[model samples]
Target: MGEDRREDMLDALHRLAEELGETPTTTEMNDRGEYWASQYQNEFGGWNEALREAGFEPNQVWKVPTDDLLNEIRQLARELNQTPTKEQMDDRGEYYGRSYLKRFGSWNEAVRQAGLEPNQRISQSAFREPPDACRLCGDAPDAGLDFHHWRYGENKAGCYLCRTCHDDVHAGGMRPDNDPGWLMGAVENLIRCHAKYSEETSVPAITSRYNIPSEGLVASAMSNVEM
Candidate 1:
């Protein structure tokens, strides 16, 4: 009887894969599958393994054009009436932000590729370690400094900043409509902060690790920096 139930579950996965003409997600399996996705989880250890047994590819980014993924982001941005932030994407986005980060190196970059403005968030940034003090102002709170993403949604490309500087950068300096001088000054300051905290890391190391494209004008500009 136990073996029969297991066989039934496998059969269900196969049926669903055939019906969908592609691998079905857990949600779709639950909705239209002959057996519960949970049952497959129990029998096959996990969903992807179950898919493997059923002769389908494991769950992964579809082999569609990158533009298709960017289009999804644009569609979400339109619905939000602005570029969608990571939080907004979490709540309503069809695809996961992690996927976008992997594909585009940063969420803000992804937005730019989609021909949209990067959503700016003040008083917030991503950090690898617990922020003990602001990299900019040296203001150390007991609760610690806020992690500020240098670029929106690029948590890896971030540093700690006090609430004040963080707010200021997002509110004006980061905006494309901001004064060009102010933007340049702000960029310089942030680069200094990053250099101080990065412990002699080189520009090429950073660019290579994050898949940052540094060509033409960008390459020339970076060459002037001390790395």
Candidate 2:
């Protein structure tokens, strides 16, 4: 029975992917699918896993540059005069708040990093700086480690992951934001400056000198830098 359900879900996902011309998000699948999104989540341990089994790349947040993400969040907050919620982001942001939550560990943390006052649902949690090796496998590869939100959807820090571990967690998924339109010229300048400053300057100093938004942005820029 379980195997039957899995095959059915995979078939459904394949059909949806074909119709959409891309991998459908859980929300997208729920809105237009025969099966509930949670059903897939439950059966496959995660929506991404289901997508993996179905031969589609799951949604990947890391591909989107953090600076681009923060700018949008800050812009939306300024427009709304308050920190935007996930629902609000859905209505207005170019990227989903789910992506922000996955990347930053929580919506509130992403909001705080946007230089906006979060609603304070939880007290501040310190962010774990990117580590040299994959926290799970402890494999230090030549490629810089990727940050993984171990405590996703919460006010807590996450850990580092190498590409292999990152791919496993993401179910070997492709990033959703493949369009190059979001990479504005200013972003290039910000990353270049951040990469140069990251070598010797502290995050605060880099932010002050470049007028960058927050330490989180600096951290993000540094993380993307080639180690």
lDDT to native, each model: 0.58, 0.58
- Cα-based TM-score, every candidate: 0.39, 0.30
Stretches off by above 4 angstroms in model 1 are 1-49, 53-55, 58-65, 120-227
**lDDT string, candidate 1, 11-110, tens digits:** 8876665444346789978887887788788788998898887666785523435776788788987786666765556567766565566667666677
How much is the lDDT of residue 202 in candidate 2? 58
Give per-residue CA lDDT, model 2, range 1-227, as digits (tens): 48887899899987765443356777878887778899988888998888888876666421456787888888887787655666667677777666676678766577768887443221122122333334345456787887644233654333455776556544413222543332222223344533442453555644443333356756665565554
Q: In model 2, what lDDT does residue 53 have?
A: 84
Error of 2 at 222 (Å): 41
Predicted model with the maximum TM-score: 1
